[model samples]
Target: MPRAVRSPADFWSGALFAGFGIAFAVAALAYEPGRATRMGPGFFPFALAVVLSLIGLATLVRSWLRAGPPPLGLTSRPMVLVLGAVVAFGAMLHALGLAAALCFVVLVSASASSRFRWPRALLLAGAVSGLSVLVFATALQLPIPVLGRWLGG
Candidate 1:
């Protein structure tokens, strides 16, 4: 009898995780991974890769052991919109500044949802922008401007 996948989604997800983990692990090997006490540049990446690979292996095993929901069909709309939002964020960061770029990103990304609402999206954008400014600008002291040249900052 031919073997069949119990959970297609889990199987694919596991494959993706394992692939990325392996790739990153290999790349991490380029840098010296020091001991736990004195971790080198590659230590963190290597550690994360190991964990990810283990999780992927476990998920792959589980996929064969238990049934799960049907695999979801691909949808291009959300993907395109989300990718566009990222590109927009990058482009607008310097021109529009961090806060405005973040807000635009939020609005554009939120629009990808079927149940998107302008009001809710706006609120979320404000909150995210404010928190990002506080964390990245104030706390971390990054040089990202609050308002860019276009915004008269």
Candidate 2:
């Protein structure tokens, strides 16, 4: 008897990963992928894509062998909110800076959950924003201003 997929989520995720990997690997070929020693623009991407494809293939095979919980159906509200949160981060990053953007994203995305609470969300936002600022700005010394131009940084 032929084995069937035991985990639809894993199967689909693997398919997506493999599909994108293959597409990226193919696209990488358009650029000059020099030898490993020399290294070209396409080499790193091509290599990563190949690895991604392999991982995806492995996941797909495992999906057929193991059982797992079914994938959750997508909800419009959460989807929109999550996606919008990302967009908001990008929009705010330049003017408000990384710190504010991080907080905004966390709060906005957190609101998508049914049990959303303002105080918890605020705490999370503060933690996330503070951590990001410490890592990206303080430690890495990235060019992004802490408060941004709008805030007179």
> Candidate 1: lDDT over CA atoms?
0.90
Top-TM-score structure, candidate number: 1
Cα-based lDDT at residue 61, candidate 1: 84
TM-score of every candidate relative to the true structure: 0.54, 0.53
Q: For every model in order, what is the number of clashing pairs?
A: 0, 0
* TM-score for candidate 2, residues paired by index: 0.53
- The sequence of per-residue lDDT tens digits that candidate 2 reaches over residues 1-153 is 134889888888889899999999999999998987899999999999999999899989989999877688778999999999999888888898888888899999999999999999999999989987899889998877678668777
Q: In model 1, where do residues sit more than 4 Å from their true spots?
A: 1-3, 35-39, 71-74, 93-153
Error of 1 at 53 (Å): 1.3
- Tens-digit per-residue lDDT, 7-41, candidate 1: 87898888889889999999999999888899999
Q: How many backbone clashes does candidate 1 have?
A: 0
